[model samples]
Target: MTGKVLPLGLPLAIGFVAQLAISFTDAALVTRLGARELAGVTLALSVFSMTMLFGLGIVTAATPKLAAAHRSRDTGAVRTWYVQGAWLAVLVGLLGTAVLWQTRDILTLLGQSPSSARIAQRYNTGAAVGLPFFLLYVNARGLLTGVGRPKPVTWVMLAAVPVNLGLGCLLTFGAGPVPGLGVFGAGLASTLVRALVVVAVTAVLLGGGFRELALRGARLVPRPAMLLDLARVGVWIGARILLGEGFLPVLAFFVARFGADATTAHAIGLRLESLVVVFALGFSGAATTVAAWARADGDWRALRDLRSSLLLIGLVYSLGLSAVILASSGFTGRVVFGLHEPKAEGMLHKLVFLVVAYFVVDTLITMSMGYLVGLSDTRLPTLVVAAGYWVVGLGTGVLLSELTPLDFYGLWLGVITGGCVIAVFVFARTGQHIASLANSTTEEAPE
Candidate 1:
């Protein structure tokens, strides 16, 4: 499992590191401006992440379907997945951009102050420009990833790191020949960097890479059946994202109620903690890639083994990172982030502790999602994710925060409790599923 998963995961994880560095750098750069500015940036980013869910869902739905087609040596089906997925991705991206443009109004409705809302609007507007392009990139990458050729995507991502960071710093702080544009500049820089990534990917798609996949024969129009097939699974995944990441704004709303300091601190805490979670996400992708291939190859035993191995790898990885966070977050809070204001560092420290549990469950949560997605089993996991993230997790947090003495701490406590619930339930669900598969095979065995 380690040998198989690490090669796939390592490149993606490295890509995530570059991606997280952009976030870290963005937060650090924005923080120098003001707490409110930091809060606004966080709000804008949360909106971006939320809006991209649909585009991401398209990729998820396309990946397994494409992989299955590839495995069976179904050239026509592969061409259909590739062609139809490209068109669908374009549609998802355009829609996503439109949705993101509404961020300011949403933020205002969520109770953010007028100044912060304006700042977020400015940032989001620039980010919106890149949405369609980013989704295009998603589809382009999906072509390769579905065929298990993901190392190139990692390389593309790593190359973008410097472009993203350098332009961000240049536009943000104003080097020679440029005016510092502050938070808005940071957003614009990201958009520009994403544009380059899109161009790079499109070049690959049309270049030798195209001939490699035999994409020359694929039509560039929507195939109704294929679109529906993709969307059947995609809608559920999007719902999961809408509910899971959608809770961010709700959580943000609660932090907003607390004050700017709390909101800013929470933003930092979330960004910092995301570093660890990204690794889990990377591993989840690996699991998905492996599972998709295994299923396509009719390797049920491999999937069963993968379940245990993914859990084992995820837990160990989660534990190691959690320990590092527990040990170093305080120093990182005060020194690395320079978050030494009253209650700022303390708030970050507490969030670090809270995220430990988040990561622990997240490792399994990510694995479960990957495991299920490969089986074309998204609907049940969608229910499970909704229960965990929205109902149990956020619901419990809101209850404790509102009604109990734990206050903010109560919210985190509830989140962890919910996480544990999710871990148990998802695993139980997977167990039943695997058992049924085993039983069916047993019954079908020759007498």
Candidate 2:
């Protein structure tokens, strides 16, 4: 078990670390460019992430389905899922980009500074332009993981990081013949690198890569039935992501009320907190993979065991992360955000605590949903986040900002509140459903 776990966990761990490095490079570079640039890029990245997640959610729906098919050695279904998933990614990505492009001018109306808005438009335009490539990578990865070919992803991602980091730096800061285009240049470079990664991964998949799913061309066309089933799951997950990722910019909007530097600090704090959150996500990713495989095999016992293991994993990891966030709050601010303002100092610990609390809830939510998603239970979780974030969380945040001393902190408070609600709601619903499932299985068993 230990040996089996290590192979899966280690690569994920490394990938998470590499992602952190990419984020850190962004911060370090933009922070040096200036606070306004940081704030601008923050807004850009926030929008970019929101748009990107819709396609990613759709692609993610493939993993467990593919994993389960692989477990049963169903090569045709595996190939079918892969092809359909890719086609779906392209369609979603194209549509999402169109939506984002139409909404590009809204950043100014959203209260960003004129200069920040301009920079944001530039960065977002560059980043958003790469959505198709990005979606292809995500869909391909899901298919690859489903067929137990994660090692290739690990290798490609590892290679992509250094290239991504170096190019982003070179383009932003200007190296040799490359002109320094500031943070916008960085966005361009990041997008380009991501495109390369997708191309490389796609090539590997097409060329009988990683144990070969032995895909049949006839089977490779879109499977409307399979696509619909996954889309049902995908839409709900996409809404969940939209609420979750969309809330960040809204929070940034509220923080902008505090001034540019405050907004920059909020963005900095948000990204820094992601380092801790990513660790939990690494586990979530692994759980999602394992759960999908178990579900496909009809191994209810194994599915239950996988969920238990992931919950335990999330608990231990979340606690350690909470401690680190609380203990090193000041140091993290200095190192990660480069905070020198006296006002920002007092809020740093509060900010880190709020972020940590949010992640603790998030980790549990991810574990529960990842498992339930494997079982194709989507509507409940979607409803949970919809009610939690929009009604309970965002409503309270808006009202309390007027009533209390919480300003930007109010935004973080909203996130914590929303995440807690979603976590509790999802857990209870999943538990009840799983219990009913177990009872049904038992009733049918041995009869």
**lDDT, candidates in the order shown:** 0.76, 0.72
- Which regions of candidate 2 deviate over 4 angstroms? 1-10, 20-38, 100-103, 169-184, 206-209, 215-220, 252-269, 395-415
What is the C-alpha lDDT profile of model 1 across 311-346, one tens digit per residue?
A: 888888889888987898878777777787867677
- Residue 21 Cα positional deviation in candidate 1, in Å, after optimal superposition: 3.5
Q: How do the residues 1-447 of candidate 2 rate in per-residue lDDT, one tens digit apiece? A: 223334565566666576546555665678888888888887776667677777777777877777777888888777777788877887788887775564347777776678887877777666666777777777777776666556677788788878877888888889788789887787787779778888888678767555455543535467688778778788887777676666665677677777766676677677766656665545555666776776555556666566567667777878787898789888877876678887777666667777777877887876667667666676777777878887888877776776788876776787778888888787676566556657767887885
Q: lDDT at 433 for candidate 1?
A: 60
Q: How accurate locally is residue 34 in candidate 1, as Cα lDDT from 0 to 100?
A: 90
User: Candidate 2: lDDT of 3?
Assistant: 38
TM-score of each: 0.87, 0.86
Range of the 10 consecutive residues with the lowest summed lDDT in candidate 2: 1-10
Best-fitting candidate, measured by lDDT? 1
